[model samples]
Target: MSPGPGAGSAPASLTATDKVSTFSSFRVRNYRIHFFGNAISNIGTWMQRIAQDWLVHELTGSAAAVGITLALQFLPMLLFGLYGGVLADRVDKRKLLIGTQAALGLTGLTLAALTFTDVVNVYHVYVLAFLVGLVTVVDNPARQTFVSDMVGPRLLRNAVSLNSANFQSARLIGPAVAGVMIAAVGGAWAFLANGLSFIAPIIGLLMMRTSELNPAERVPRGRGQLRDGLRYVGGRPDLLWMIVLVGFIGTFGYNFAIWLVAFTDQVFASGPGTFGLLNSLMAGGSVVGALLAARRGSNRTRFTVGAAAVFSSLLVVASAAPNFVVFAVLMPLIGLAGMTFQVTANSTIQISSDPAMRGRVISLFMMVFVGGTPIGGPLVGWLSDEFGARVGLISGGLVCLAAAVGVALILARIGGLRLRISLRAGSRGLALVPRDPEEVTAPAGAAIRPVA
Candidate 1:
């Protein structure tokens, strides 16, 4: 059975004093190669993302059109993400990744060719986006588990944090470059660069010495594997509740593409350059959040929940910003809190899960986190079109805020924890205090049995 949070056997070796270095994961040769190669590819991916959104908007001149594009890109994940995880557990991740990555590159090249030929329409973009999503269904879980393959459990958290940092750092470059490139030539060039960029990672994967890697034990082909994964998650409150919170937040609160484009054209009267600037600002904050997560000693569930609340609050505040400058300034805080919550949740789940079940577990985590985009994108897009951009943003933030508080109460109740208030000045007043241990052992209808 998969372990719950704070019950994983692998983390027992490290004590408070044995705090890991922020860059300790770099000591692994294979991880280093994987990091740099992914760095280049992530930048390319971000560029394509920005260009694609802008291209769709430019072609259709409607925020709802962009929403449709986003929905199409993520639809496959909602449909086939679990099967991809099962495949990851059964196959060699390294070889599977090569095939997926090549396929993704081909999609990029196809889009670029169509764009350059002057025959590309919104339909072509929709089809290519869908194809990329299909590749991502398998690629996402395999790539996530591959970190464990490279660095083992001890460095897994650090590597994951660094991976976020790397991707955010690329965001800093990709959007700025893409904005300028699209302005200078067109979106086609950005697509071309992203297509060519895949060569770097493919080369890196080929160069790795397979002997030194610590691959997980592959699960044999069998029936009922998907059901097994669902049961494992259902039995663990920590995993299930965290997934629930992220799902709510991801669905409603994370529809930035629609809001950003609407605000840029309608609210700020700006263009792609301003959009790129806004994205870069948020990416900068994400980098900081990632590094902070890497430097931390542990991933506490409370900390993750707190970050979610803070992120939601910031979104509400950003929605009401008086001017472009104010909204722009607030993006970093939103990004920071969001990234901190994401990194903590991801590492916590991975560290807590059984190695054999890690792929399926992470797949479920991602399925809820990202697979909700299809449902959310169009809804938010229509809200922006009918009501306004600010209204859409505020509505999402309110939903997320409510989810955070509700989940906190449920967790505390299940764990026999109570909120304690102190009237004394200069004290840590409010806290969740534990009740009698026996009371929590099998709380009425509680599914959270602590892992001993």
Candidate 2:
């Protein structure tokens, strides 16, 4: 398929060399080590997530508790994300990551020990989850901005997409492995494995050739840095709308992790294996979506919006599925749409933001994207507990659809552009034609670079 208008003018090309070069970011030695380490570490992270949710469900048998756990895990992001972004701008991301990972590993090990000793309780899980969330406030933004420092601008998008691909691939393997591990030795083993997994990322960080790392743009620490970052995003309508769109989908639409457990337990009357299978199916689709985004290249606002629309629609369809088999068949589609929107939104934020303010801007992006979980997770969980799992899923999907439509309409009006939707493939279905061409061009010597 040809590139869409929102994607800028990049060609759709995915050759063997491109695939190889996509990993070129790893050739930096530092990034390569970080890549492998993070890959291993993230697998353990996913394992812990599955184990944690299942453990909570087993203890309380309530979907609302699962949601509350998720909220606790993300509430730190909502509360401290902006400050975390400010810290990312001011500190060495590598050093910060090492400490955070260590803390995370310890948290996993503590939970493992607690569970293994048979002293685990729901309150313990809640406290541990909250602590993990607190660490993530700093860990996530630093990690997001650290990618650019690893490869520089030349391969930022590729690195981001590849990172996402690794995440999804881990998603595919981690849950199934965790399911088997949990079934065999129990959830404690899974948690213990996650603690052990941190060894890899720590090794990667220690072994990395820091001298070869890309020079980070050091932002001057000032009193109004937070306000500055906010103003920066406020000036760009595209970035503002993109972040808003993502926030809506993230908050109301993307509660798959929470919903999946409910669906498997309450709806399908299934076990851990079935739950793992459903997640793996979604991961398969997400992998495809990430690859497609990588192939399409940078600056695709239209594709991002379109993907949001498709993601919402897929969720709606998936919610209505009558059987597990049908739901499984449709999961990949939902995964694809979800990942597509994520990759596109992430790329747009990274490519568009000013270098000095990138960390803070991306933090805001993360705040909206992840911070919404605290607000949404409990709501979805409550809905599932009060009504049914399907209602929770369907409500999320409907909200996503409405948000997408509303954002697109607002963008169209502000830009003075007409948007036309069509079912045709490889076509510019939505074109943004300014009433005056001169007004659309970047002002001379403007700091904002045109997205390529």
Candidate 3:
């Protein structure tokens, strides 16, 4: 018989001590190197994100221009995401990542040079954004699936949570620094800084011990592998439902850069510092949410649905704030709920996939999650431009709310779950529990098994 997945590598089962340590993944030397490297690179990525949007706005003074840039940036994913995943399955992930990282860094430097030379224009922004998206199409899936290789099956969830923490922690710093650079010196420095940050990951990947990784089964040269990936997802109700919910929410509800910039300019009448500060606040909340997911050690489809519902509702609340302070207060709350939804949904999809098809599966997941931005980003940008930020915010939130509700209802029927409510001692609680007693518990983080 063929060796099982993760054979000759770390097992999925955890030791008692492993369970106690929330940062179990950190114990792995490879992952520790990757974690720090990713943290530095991610900070640079965040800075570029802020500077890019700001640059677009500065050039055109049109929110719609920012939206168009956002739309263009993700268009390559919609076009080539699945193909990238196919390559990831067939190619050496580490080498592919090194190439993509180098390309991305060069792209950053190209934009920085144009800006610093004072010749950057709206067309330049559009072209460069599209180019970056092309690189991201390959990089996103490879980077995502590579986590399993570094930590094996044992600390996959913990590692995923820690990755989010590292990314968000960077967000906590990157935007603030970007804002200061934009305000005090200039936006060109932010772009230049991001270009250099890619060095950290390049060094990390070079230093890693290749003998230690748990390599996934490579797909043989064959036809119909793409169809195989589609069929794999099509057959799973849990994965299907989760993807549908996130598709709606992510497309409409997560246009933060566009809206936050609008809010800063129109509502607050403030500068880049306020805009960056708000993003940093949301990142702070994301860091908190990520740490909570790590410590709680829970991963279920229900958490994905429940968090989406709460997060969308909070977005609606955020839209109605009377001033920047009230709006700022709501950002952290939104960030918490958003991170809960994102991290849990990500884990659900990754854990549910077969090892052989993990890269293709993750690519599909990201295509829907981020690729839909092209459709939503421009439209939402248009809405904000014409109707103002409050209306745009409310509309996006309501659509997200509707999507979450739809998922819960569909899952309840398929899983034979029932809603239960209790009011005692002046306390109230609500639950969606399996109708069968045996369904109350299972392996930790098991996807809720839907009845056929």
Candidate 4:
């Protein structure tokens, strides 16, 4: 369970006793700029998401059609994600991100123009979504690893947690704003706003001080690097199982876009405002979970597995809620658990992998995390179409719950750890403790570092 090749040395400044700042990464001017720029961009991105899904749903009046839109958008990632990761490892990350970001913005603008002209169709939406996905194949991996370049290893976990907080915090606004704009002006305005929001991130990337960044050693042009990355991950049990677990949860459990629309239209018979409210409530929970993770400052497999279990279980319960209020009550808790699981898994993999292989590793992670939307979205849409939205949601939750249990058992067996549940008054309760206390402390993946 040793760290895979290129697990760079711990930052020299980090120590056991250093007080961890919840916003430590903000101390760095570079990360601060990156944070604020992405914040604005993320809001726009969420707004576009709301508008796009609503547009597709409105045009076709079928949940399956919305699923198809999501499928097309993510199909490129399934097809070319590994190659994107390889490219990310070779190129200047900052420069590559700027290009991808600009391309994404243009796609938004093109969609806006077509909609404004009154000639937009579902096919146009599908094509534009696919184009955005193509850019994201490169953008996601580059953006993920760039945090390392911005703040170095010392504040990586905190920075990563804050990044989630940033996205979710924007989620708190994006859907509400998009809902209002869609009701007042049109989806076209939302698209236009999204396209313009790209300017902020592009400017932020330009404003960065290159000298202060901690760039990884860029891999030179070569063949077989993709295979090499796959092999590297294959040889590590920790990385493999963690990625598998996330793949299941992300693909099956995280199709909120599809499910929310289905529920709003079919079950609740509500409009975009309710949909926006639902998303905002969940986002509020996500923002809280991410900030809590930032404060917690340590990653452990048990915590991740537990969070996944809680998240998936909540999904199951939510599907059975008797009314909108009951369903809405669960959204924030689901968001909290889901975000906790995500931030923990993401930071763990990022920190544990060799720096040289980070892009590929992260790409593989993103590939499964988002790329599976193509496969799951359509199927879930069909289920919602055939049976009911509740059935579709509950099925996905069951799959995720099963996957979490399976992964936990696999990791426990591999690590020779057993589940321990304490009933003592002062006990924190459930944990995974090594069967042989004398055995060498669990592998690097299971090791803990105090956040600083």
The TM-score leader among the candidates is 1
Arranged by TM-score with the best first, the candidates are 1, 3, 4, 2
- Give the alpha carbon lDDT tens digit for every residue of 53-88 in model 1: 999999998888888998898889889989888998
Model 3 quality (TM-score): 0.93
Better of 1 and 2 by lDDT: 1
Query: Candidate 1: where are CA atoms >4 Å away?
Result: 1-19, 436-452
Q: For all the candidates, what are their Cα RMSDs to the real structure?
A: 3.6, 6.2, 3.9, 4.4
Q: For candidate 3, write residues 18-118 as lDDT tens digits.
A: 66356888877888899998888999999999999998998998778888998899999888888888888887788888999899999889899999999
Task: Please count the clashing residue pairs in each candidate, in the order shown.
Answer: 0, 3, 0, 2
TM-scores, in order shown?
Answer: 0.94, 0.90, 0.93, 0.92
**What C-alpha lDDT, on a 0 to 100 scale, does residue 347 get in candidate 3?**
72
What would you estimate as the lDDT of candidate 3?
A: 0.85
The residue pairs in collision within model 3 are none
> In candidate 2, what are the lDDT values of residues 329-353, reduced to their tens digit?
9988888889989987897788788
How does candidate 2 score on lDDT? 0.83
